[model samples]
Target: MDKMRVSGDRFVNERGEQVIFNGINLVEKDPANDMITPGGDRLYEQLATHGFNLIRFGIYWNKVEPAPGQIDMAYLGRVAAQIQLAARHELYVFLDMHQDLYAAKWGDGAPDWAVQDDGLAFNRSGLWSDSYFISPGLHHAQDHFWANDPASDGVGLTDHYLHAWQAIAKYFLEADNVIGFDLMNEPFPGSQAQEIVQAVLGYAGQRFQVTPDQLMAMWLDDTAKQKLLAQLNEGDTYSAVLQAMTPAVQAFETQTLNPFYEKMAAGLHDLLNGKALFLESSVFANIGVPSALTFTADNSLVYAPHAYDLVVDTNHFESYSTARLDHSLKVIRATQEKAGVPVVLGEWGAYFNQPETKAISEFHIQHVEANQWSQTYWSYYPEFFSSPTAAVLDRPYPQAINGDLRRYRYDPATQQFELAFKTLPGTSRIFVPHLATVELSQLAAQGMRADKRALPGGTGGVLFITADREQEVVLHLQIG
Candidate 1:
């Protein structure tokens, strides 16, 4: 129940109760801003005032290390400051090494040195393929990832990645303010099912001798990478190839994913035991198999599935559908059950309002609410900060604060607003974001339980309060 600890099982609060609530996703479009990259303390504090005590924070891997073996201390310092800010706000921080489509250019993942040239020269301005507006490098890596022969170092990249994480962990070893590391954000396993299977096989054969789909009860970080590398080539014989691939794949499953959890947890105890750690498995249900993994302990550990309706639907594997979300639950529930951790739907939302999505979302909300687990929508954003088209509330973000943007679009070219906002309403602070439509008080009525209240500002603002039953919060809205 202690909030300081998070294992392979549950996210228990200091009271030893499993924690659940609506939270914020904090990543800045403008790195120059004081929050996120430059000065995030203000941003953190702002989010706190708006009824958010949990935050999904993102950092690009390349920003930390533009070159292999070289880590930017200044960048790490910036991140540590953000971590401190979260603590000050009494918010839970899930520091995410986020990437989209993959590559330093795409958003943030591998350093420039990690770019793999697999002959994928296709370019895309805004399209979702290998080429890029800046360079073909980002596109090239994306191609290989989907082409199935990902040059993830298979060994080298993973090693550098782990080491980079270790360096970051060292700085925040004593910070009890943050929650856990989300490891890698979204990993694509492309079109090669056989290779995917083989990668796991190789992982098992090399590291814990795990059988395919077996629990890697004992995983050793020291030698796992080497074992994986040894098996990447397999052998001239196809059987040898299969055997090698098994351990490689299994090794990746356990090591690439879980070791991050293990290190963060172990470091907290050994180096900074008071801290908590949770694993955000690769992209949720990208494949039918969920990538969620576990650390040693079974308490306060959450295996998050970043689900999109379309991803779960798997037909377009392209369109988003909440109704199809159960497909994700079914694929991933097994792992979470085995690890004995709550299944955290790290991200979920509808691109458009669909009854099926609503039903599926309700099911998910009920599941999380029934068990008191927490899940967050895909994002939180403002319109004026960027192009109105890019706002979390404007187009695609599954906003929880306010909804029905078609009627809310303040302008024609832009449907979204600007800068994730929080305001101090009158006597009672009330918060209604531009996109959030879910009524927390109403949800409570439906048996979906969470610490929620209707803001005093009739439509938009929130009163911030600490975790105390005696705390009285009220907000007053100012109508235009």
Candidate 2:
């Protein structure tokens, strides 16, 4: 459970081995259950058994500070207890200050005492995420938060948020396995989102030879919306729309989001010595818009973006397109290049129980592997192992590399895992799902010896390989 640090677009452990985290999200937005998701110990045990080494653990600001100036130790204790459970099972975790529409009343974020909605009506719309576009209450509250509006006790909201993070950090100062803090989850641009939407619609209107108003009408119609999403299945078509909205999106990110992050990170940077700050782009970026996010603090930072298609959070899961998702990754990659940070996709794969869930998960995993980016899938539940996605989650991966990883890929269909790296003096670890039947080829004859130890649950095990000679080497494993 050594600390993980950002090392030139890669996560490296205390032993200096490059680490790639393959994991799932553990989040609970419901307040009735005290904002804690019920998984107990078995949940983490299953995640570890499935070869997951990371958890994008969600913690709400509402739960952190239910009232301004009143930090909740009980809530922090509960969250810490879960992190301990994850650590007990050898899982690394990063805390995501999860929010949806900005406040606990709308989604799960700021407390009720902190929400300054200005008496605006909350218009519940088509989907849960639709409120981000249609609810004035949400926008108003978010605007105040970004503006650092004074709360009932007269302290600014953003200031309170920074304080909340510091409190959380102090609480977990000794929690060695708590790797980092995802500053915020899916940060929306308050009321400026309308301008971004207009930019997209304006570009789409001209492309379709219709007015923005007319396009809005079509978007509200279910069948027409599905057809519109289908049109975006073409990568070029989706890229064009994303490019059109880039200016507006960039303005909000560079002007508003970047400053907000700077302030928060500056306040918390001293507390996070070895832990990286996970930065998520604007919520609009989830659908493929490029971000202009940049951090000025000279601390470890990760380009943590959430990639999803327009079909997410809707009943139109069948309309999900890899072309669109591929384009989304393209945009996120551009942002990552600009930031020059390691990427850990904080959220993806929310296609719940779709007939294509397995295919969709596999497609996303392949791209993630190709890019060599770490990721935490959207979520985990008690019965998550029974889902089609669970199998895809257990695919082989390099848990930690002793040297620079040239490339790695796992073909589930063939049960073949291949890894190429510049060998160092120490052992490199790989997680093989079916370790007992795993057979090493080529490398075993090339002065490399693999020590396989079955993990606790016996479903998977780690292959620790040490090379006799220090040079570039490729190891292939047949795990079927």
- Strongest candidate by TM-score: 2
Cα deviation of 105, candidate 2, in Å:
0.7
- Tens digits of per-residue lDDT, candidate 1, 288-385, equal 34454554553545576665542332222223333344555555666666777655566665233333343344455545443445565555554212
The CA lDDT of each predicted structure is 0.47, 0.85
In model 2, the clashing pairs are: none
In candidate 2, what are the lDDT values of residues 46-101, reduced to their tens digit?
A: 78878999999889988888888789999899899999998898899999999888
Stretches off by above 4 angstroms in model 2 are: 296-299, 440-443
Judge candidate 2 at residue 401 and give its lDDT: 94
- Which 10 consecutive residues of model 2 have the lowest summed lDDT? 438-447
